[model samples]
Target: MPAARESLLDAARTSLARRPWSTVRMVDVAALAGVSRQTLYNEFGGKDGLARSLVRRETDRYLAGAERALAEGGLPAAADWTVTRARENALLRAVLTGCWTEGLPAPAPTAAPSTSPVPAQRRADGPLPTPAEVIALVRDRAVAVLAPATSTAGARATLARDCEVALRLALSCLLAPAGDGGTAGLVREAVAPIPYGAGR
Candidate 1:
């Protein structure tokens, strides 16, 4: 089922890239995934559910990548990852910035209860994160991984502020383009303990 689910999602993503989400046919998606329409329905509950799941999957991957970057190279690397990902993915960029352009499927938050038996679908049916929430989520993740156990309350608070600033800087880089190296250098400067403080 997991493999089938991923196949359906992959097909959907390819279809989305080719045309508008509005014109994407469920039957086509099912055929592309090599599953029946009823299987798609059982997996996703419907198109709205599929949309939510798609967004949720991207959001999860985005956060996972940020966490990995943070673990590997701290806040600046995470910022670099953020800028890179947002630049490459229109849906993710829109999700991060709260800007949904034409032809994109922007999944709205649902007030109705989810009755999907699928665990992933049920989670997807839950409230999706807004742009602000995405920022805070990434910032908090940075703090969680980067914060030292011995750091004081004030130190952790300062770290949180710095993480938020670095993340926002990444977002800014999306709105305003950077050089060939993209956000790495700019993010490194912003997250530096003492930016531009001394000669090399």
Candidate 2:
């Protein structure tokens, strides 16, 4: 069942690369996955469910990257990792902002509006897990990953606050990218206050 679900998600992802999520159809996904439409429905309940699952999967991937970065054990290392991941994954920026419209070119004026409604779960304001919520989630995960790297009681107490700063700085860099030294400089500035131990 997990493999079948993954296959459907893979098909959906491929379709999404070619077209907007608003236009992706479950039937096409099923066909691409070599499964019956009923099977797709059974697995995901509907398009909205499928979309949520996809978002969750992508979020997990992003967090995994973040965990690996924090495991490297220094503010500078984490900053570099965050910036690199943002550059490599366009989806990460979109997820961080709760808006997926970035990087996509505006549709031609003559193009017809999609007949399909935007998923009801997604609103004009934005998607689930607002930017603040996402930042908090990332900060919490980062603190956990970085906790072992900190030695002093003072460092542990301040780790969460420091992570919040780091994540916010990274998001800012992603939204308004700086040239060459700009992002690295900003990251260093953000992490300057965070305490770290040797060999971490």
**lDDT scores of the candidates, listed in order:** 0.82, 0.64
Q: Measure candidate 2: CA RMSD.
A: 7.4
RMSD of each: 3.2, 7.4
lDDT of 2: 0.64
User: Which stretches of candidate 2 lie above 4 Å from their native place?
Assistant: 87-90, 102-128, 149-153, 197-200
Error of 1 at 181 (Å): 6.1
Task: Please provide, for model 2 over 97-192, each residue's C-alpha lDDT reduced to its tens digit, 9 standing for 90 to 100.
Answer: 655673332222123322223332132113446568877776777666666653566766677677777677776777677567665566666566
* lDDT score, candidate 1, position 16: 87
Candidate 2 weakest lDDT stretch, 10 residues: 105-114
- TM-score for candidate 1: 0.92
> Which pairs clash inside model 2?
none
After superposition, the stretches of candidate 1 with alpha carbons farther than 4 Å from their true spots are 179-181, 194-200
> How many Å off is the CA of 106 in candidate 1?
0.9
